[model samples]
Target chain A: MSDLVSRHVGPIVLDGGIGGGAMESQIRFTGTAVPLRIEIDFPHRMNESVVQDIDTAIDSTDYTDRLARQTIAAGVHRTGTCAAKPYASWTAARGERPADPTEFAGALTLRRMIIFPDGGRNNPERVAMIYSLPDTSDEHPIEVRFLQPSGPELCPVNVRPRV
Target chain B: MSDYDDLGGLVARMKKAAIDCYMAEDGFNPHWNDNQKYAKWGWAYHHYARPDANGEGGGSPLTATTTLEAQGSVAPRFDEIRSTIDTILTGWDTLPSGALCRAPQSSANAATALLGGAASVATVNDSDEIVRATETAMASLNDLAGSFVGPVYDKYCAQLLTVTQNLGTVYTILEAQYAAQQAMWPAAREDVVAICTSAAAAWEGRAAEIAAGARQDSFTVVAAVAGAVATVATAGVGTAATVGAVGAFASTTVSTLSSLDASGGHVSGDTYAEILASLVGALGALNETIAAQELELNRWLDETLNAMSTQLADYNLDAFTLADFSAGDGSSSINRTDTDMITTAMGRVEGALSEALRAAGAPPVSNPTPRPHAIGVGLAGTHLAASGVYDYANQCLQSTAAEYTRGRGLFDAAVADYFNTDAESQLKVTTLLSQEALIAEMGGRG
Candidate 1:
């Protein structure tokens, strides 16, 4: 009288993890290999180059879960943006830029950010993901871009099965 | 032709050929060295099923490992082997059937198992156990097929194809060089395999003599035949009953029964186990020979690839293209002579030797070949003698120019054949893999 079961966990996030078992494993197994870094500054945009309309920027999802579902949804959105565009970024971090590649081993990295506005400020936040081992001296940085779409915005779905 | 200016064109062409050979195997040109080529190559990789029909590589040694000079593009095949092994290991952590599915049962679901072992017993009835185990075994076989056929088999095949197709190019160059130096044109690499074959035959013949001696002398086929004749011999059909058979059993002659027993050769049952034990002991020694052959093959690949790389790197490629085709260790081709090319090739060989050593499926290293010639001198002398040969080869090219050339030819021809063979071989392996996958998708054999 035994049977197999599949249960829904929560939205999978790559930004700051929601700290659940499912989120933890996804980060370690799949995320670690993604070769990208993402950080989200809650409420404040990292760069001011892009402008946003405050009237259009409204939070539709509830924060009752303290980011278990919300964080994962954010990660899906960033991963989506990564697939859609070729990234270009100015990496000021040491070991971020290269002088000559032929002499170096190999270098490549991805930096993704989920942005949130700061207190009393209308600026969007940032979440950046960095991936690459030191042995590979390759320096190719792929920047992740996120657009806060208008209307009843949907939280991205985290597809991992919760344990 | 010795000019350096034409190198750019030559390298370009070589690079193109190299890339073409690489792409021919799996249709991805992972330069692995250069970025754009690597990226383009990487883009094509999306966990696609390998083509059906090929098992991946040819049975030829020359076809398997690439010489640095030839740019043998067989690394991917080996890579696939590594990954397949890894995947197989991953699959083993479950109910045998679950492993085939590449799905590990959750540890939390189980009560006491350490690894996330599938509660197969808990899930199914005893009647289905055999079915589940068979499904698991099938998956393991599939993993092996994929690894064996994928990058390892295909890379070797591409290499074989390129080398075989380029024989004409080698012939002309070697002919010109031989005439210039008052030397004979080098023999084909197949020549060496013939040498090895003859050598093997000679050894086997000698071993046969030894085996014959052991069977006749050491085996001691028959010893001290045993039988006895009894006095009270009676002419009767032993214990068989006749018309008046009241005393048929009691009146039977002891000698008659003994004679009947003696008709069949006398041998104790105890001897059978002894004979079997000795035979097993004799055959146990044969296993070492298998290990020895594997080691020899590894050594051949390592030493051969190392030398060819050195030679090719030094060769003048000026006449091949408007551009000088010489490549160095980031060195100038302005003075690229045969020595320089050979030297550069040696560097590549050295690199590959270390790489090959680093490679999996290496034959026995700590175990040296036992020398038959040292029967009188005993174990120590033979060990030294075998070690000496290995030591000489360690510097990369104790094998002379002639040997190197032959070896290179073999390596080239092998890869070319590998390419052609593997194109088909890979297809076959992939088909098997796909079948396995389909079976797995349908919940496997279970």
Candidate 2:
């Protein structure tokens, strides 16, 4: 398994998106010179499903291993900041007394959600998500921003399966 | 009198042309003289494919030992023909100015005394016979002189004039080709070097990005797989958590792949190689023209010698008639004007030559008829093919192609493979995640 070795040098801030179809989140890290931008978009149903799944995972339910369960819960976060806000609002939020992106000096992973379009009834397209987990920081929260997609359709144009 | 001077003038022109052919600027020098341009081209050719960092395998400059080999091929033959003409001219000057020999003075007093004393008809008739035979022999000597100094010399001189003009044409073509190359080479090298250097630097700058991107992409997939496996092994106990974790990881990998897309890591320094290829092609065209002209010249020289021999054979001087002269040289054909066949093949590359010249921005060649008298020499109607030109042309092409390949194909393939791998990993991860979702739904979970 490959692991990212770095610390976030800036606060997570929402960025504007392409015609309200996808929302972007950007954070800087110590290992990379450029800010990593995460674009989020999903159909309303998948959004509810993912949020409920996170809720279920975070539920105070019976579990043999509580640490692993809590670790998974801390890794996910939902934002009330509407992505459809004016570009100026997003920038203002990022500029308000710059929180040291390095405030959290622990291993962090940036996750993005990718949804493939359905081919046919026989070959249904499915959703898959990937994580950027740092090997040294399994305890640190894996940050995920579930942004509100304001577009008519959440799927990016022609998301091919073998792309 | 004008014809006599014309014949001498033709010989002088032939000599001048031959000497010019022997000299460097007038065409016969096969080795290219612009070392500065060559040095520039060599630098670009060798360094264009080199990576920005030191110790990368780059092209080495190609040698021109093959170019040097063309040195004596053309010039020495001109020298040999010039020397032969010089010998013939010198020998012409030593020919007898008067009758081949003085006939015994007609003794008038002895004739009168002998005729009055005995009136011997036999003695008188014998004297007459001696006079007739001497007259006939003298006339034969005069005819031999006329033939040597007139038709034989004139025909050969006329042909030599054409040959010299043809040589001049060759010289003009070679000069223009050389000039065009000189004019185009430096600019071409500069462009090539700048392109390669900039490309190499851009690629170098992206090294860190590509590495970070690759790690992020691979790490995400690996983490997702491990989480999925753990969830399955635990009998769906941590299945919801596993789905969340794997989904996050897959998204990270996808993001990294998107960022890394078109990151300039796969750029190649092929600009220089391409320029070298173009220059080599120009050189090949130039060399082919040279070979064609060379072949045409050889044919002209042969025809000139044959014409001279045919004209000279009609006035054979027997050994008995002129004690010091013999018809043997005139009776047998002389050696070919040029024994060396410079080119094994020939063709008209006029269109290609002009196009190459235009491409190089070379001034048009000054020859009125490039390949003059090609029809007269029996080459006008023939379809010809030629491949070898100064051996150096082939060497440049071969080496340039080999060197240019060093910078390009592999990098492109690598970029393609990177994308393909990324795509495959995405599909596999999505397939696994999708299966896990199906399993969760099948287990009567929300």
Candidate 3:
């Protein structure tokens, strides 16, 4: 079990797709290490079926983790669920502005998460998450952990891997 | 009475013979000195044979008051002149066995030397010096040939003329070859430099671009959002609602901005690296092309030198044969000996020249094929992978990295090869030019 470092890591947004809206979030860490990977547990208030669909959409197992690690090690930037078209679609349908407070918490629930390597800013690396954020005002407190070793250990971690 | 008359007639004929000898020896005009020709010939004979005599008469010795006595006196002097003339004629007839032979022989030798010198200069130097030298030598030979006049010296004159003329032809050929070489070397050099310089500039430019792009910091969400959006309106929502909405909206915009920022740059570090790799590959191909061209040039030069050597040898043999025939001795065997000696000497010279040409590795007469222009572009194909759409971006990075690595390795190898080749080429060109200068100097001496 990885140690969780709880903090207010936010300003996370997902935009682009059929819907013109965006998803906003304030994320919490369940771990503190490089590539922070985590499984999101949606609150009971959200629709069960919608939650299930989000779960299926953002789901990652040992296979996906290994695949992501392999991809990154090959000198590629691997994002867990950010590459998924369904996730992009979900964010866009939520509308340009944040939902009302009651709806905001449900919409911001996280299903899966992956972050890019730190770009030397001391801030968290770029994050790619599969979550149900229906509105721009969604504030999901997501749980994340250090995906041990973060990326593929075999891959170079330098700014320019090929260089 | 009859014996006295016969003696008088003999004396008269002797006077005429003496006059003819004097005119021939002194180069007097027969038409201008017709009346005095015999008188002058007799006077010279009288003066030379008997220093005590005062034989200064302008009239014919036959018309003198002491005509019979004068005729008697002048007969012995004429006899002596005839004897000397006979001796000279004998020397001319047996010329091949005496000093007279040296004239034609020396001229032949001079001709051979001039030909040899011209050939040497022609082989290494492409200049007008050899041509001028050759022309001077030919002129001298022609003058020597023209000096021999009269029927007695006809054969010798003909032989000298033939040999000299043949040598002139050889020099003419040499002059032409030198001129051609002078024009060819510089043209080829210019072409080579132009192509190589272009290639070097292209690689340098590509490497610099890659280096510049790699140094750029990745754009973060904060920068992207600030640049992307200006304001958020909150007209309908309550004060607290609007504030919460604004805060959430800010976070969402920032994250979206980050995604956009990552994808929007002209080329990623991986792609730049790939381009560098492609540049390396192009260099490798260029190096190979240069090597091949150099080799071809060397071979061509060797072949050309060999051909010229053979031609010079043939000319030398022909010149020697002509000299031998001109000896007029009908001694074919002796002529054969002389021909054999010249042939042997020429063979040695040709062999030496061939060896030297091989060592020098002469430049090509023609320009080598230009290296492929699209080498860099062709090597740097699209970096995207051949798989799933989701994997496209990552695949591009991975593929490009791999390509870059391969290209860089090739480029390094090419650079090494280029340096080595460049050094050798520089040395070769320097040596060849030096040799040319030396040959030119020698030609000037000739």
Candidate 4:
């Protein structure tokens, strides 16, 4: 019955570099925000691959469900917990894209941020507090802008697997 | 009669003779202008092999050609001639260039049919006048079926080019990353340059030698890819530098492939000689695909395949057509299967060979190499930037892939579109993605 809590981090200036090259570069945060983990939503290679699949789903609901199940089984698991309490849920990847773009929500990465039973002890998610936003659309622009969290409620999200 | 009229009389007599031969032999006669002096029996095998003919078996086609009844010339003689020509050409009735074999000769064949005003050579026997149109169609169909292949090969090749370029990009990016890591140590850009340049040159040098080694036949292709590390190391550069060198070499190879034939030409032991002449064309298409992002291959393939499919779908395989086809004596089919299997097998060999070649070159330096990220004194120091340079250099490979993937896509699409072959497409994409994945893993360890 409580309103969902919203926490903010970042506006950490990214290093002047293009591509994944500057991904590992450190981000300097604002004084109020504790320097948290950098959240990198890497674009998935299959964004376009799934586009066609989604289109096909319009024809057959059962087929779509079957494909969805298959994808989940084949997919990498990402999870997280709320830092204040280890309350967690198995969250699916979500992306915010505008039919036409003009906002931050409109930007996306093929990667996703999922919350699990315990934020994460040992998994794609490193800690209870951090979770990443998955990029699932071609329209999403992948920028490794720094993730700064307010109060420890939000931790650094799992941006990607280590290279 | 005067001598000039006498010549005209001979022309008339010869024209009547060809018509007479067709009617007597096949029970049909094609159209002709008795007034015309030249023998225009391009339909007949005897006519096709006349003196001053192109040895590759294609010749300059005429502006006014007919199918079974083009130009409203549906008489028995015209139909017979059209049918015979269609049988001989296999829906390939034109020769765009008289001197040279066309790139991906199949495409040229289709183009020829189109140019001859046959609406496609399959339409060459659309009348009752030509007794063996069905036979010609059947032979054409068989020829077309033998040429069908999946898109896997194109994808595989694209993957190869993408991975190669990706390696090059990483080396260039990481060299700077590594040198910057030495800020705490305070090293020279020149020394750094020396290390970088030497390594780069060595890798490039090896690749050049290999590329140059592609003599008149039997390209080594990816034979030495895996040994890249050792090759770079011996040139007096460290592991990081060696990466750059190897990257350079890979980039060169990818660049070389961009310009390959886009038309999806078939090559077998028997047709290998023809393929040799088309080597430059195929290379050109590959290069174009490697260099461009948005692909437009579907149209070209559709245009070419549509005609062949239509013609072959309606073929009958008469006596003469059967004879010409059987002359191949199943050698063409044998050659095709052998070549397809060989190419497929070669595809598998590439990854292993590449890995081995690189391993032989450097064999990993004592420990498995790990890519370094950044080792800064804290976030604010310029001198501290040097720590993760090696890591970045290694990581740069992924970035390079990002940049050059567009071209690979285009090339893959073109090949698939040209031949409607998924094998070609799969071949290019998978090979490239795997290379990138392996390199990223290797670099991460370093």
Q: Provide TM-scores for the models.
A: 0.13, 0.18, 0.22, 0.16
Alpha-carbon shift of residue B225 in model 3 (angstroms): 32
The candidate scoring highest on lDDT is 3
Task: Looking at model 4, give its docking quality level.
Answer: incorrect
| Candidate 4 Cα outliers beyond 4 Å, as residue runs | A1-163, B1-150, B179-184, B188-341, B344-349, B352-446
Candidate 1 displacement at residue B111 in angstroms: 62
Residues B1-446 of candidate 3: C-alpha lDDT, one tens digit per residue: 42222333333333343333232222111221133423211111112122111222222233222222333444454455445434322211111111222232233223323323333322323223223433433333333211111111221223223323343333332222223223322332332222222322332333222222211233232222222211111110121222222223223322332222111111112222232232233234333332332333233334333433344223222111111112222111112333233333333333332332232222222212222223211221111100111122122222222322332233233323333554433333333333323322112100
**Chain A fold similarity by TM-score, each prediction:** 0.22, 0.19, 0.23, 0.16
Which candidate has the highest TM-score of all? Answer: 3
Query: Which candidate wins on DockQ?
Result: 2
Candidate 4 to truth, TM: 0.16
lDDT of 1 by residue, A78-161 (tens): 544321111122122335554332211123332221222111112111222222223433343223222111101222223221
Tell me the TM-score of chain B in each candidate: 0.15, 0.18, 0.21, 0.19
Please tell me what DockQ candidate 4 reaches.
Answer: 0.00
Residue-wise C-alpha lDDT for candidate 2, range B121-232, written one tens digit per residue: 1222122221232233233323332112222222222222232222222222222222222322222223222322332232222221222222111122222222322221
Residue B378 in model 4: lDDT:
20
Better of 2 and 3 by DockQ: 2
Predictions in order: lDDT:
0.24, 0.25, 0.27, 0.24
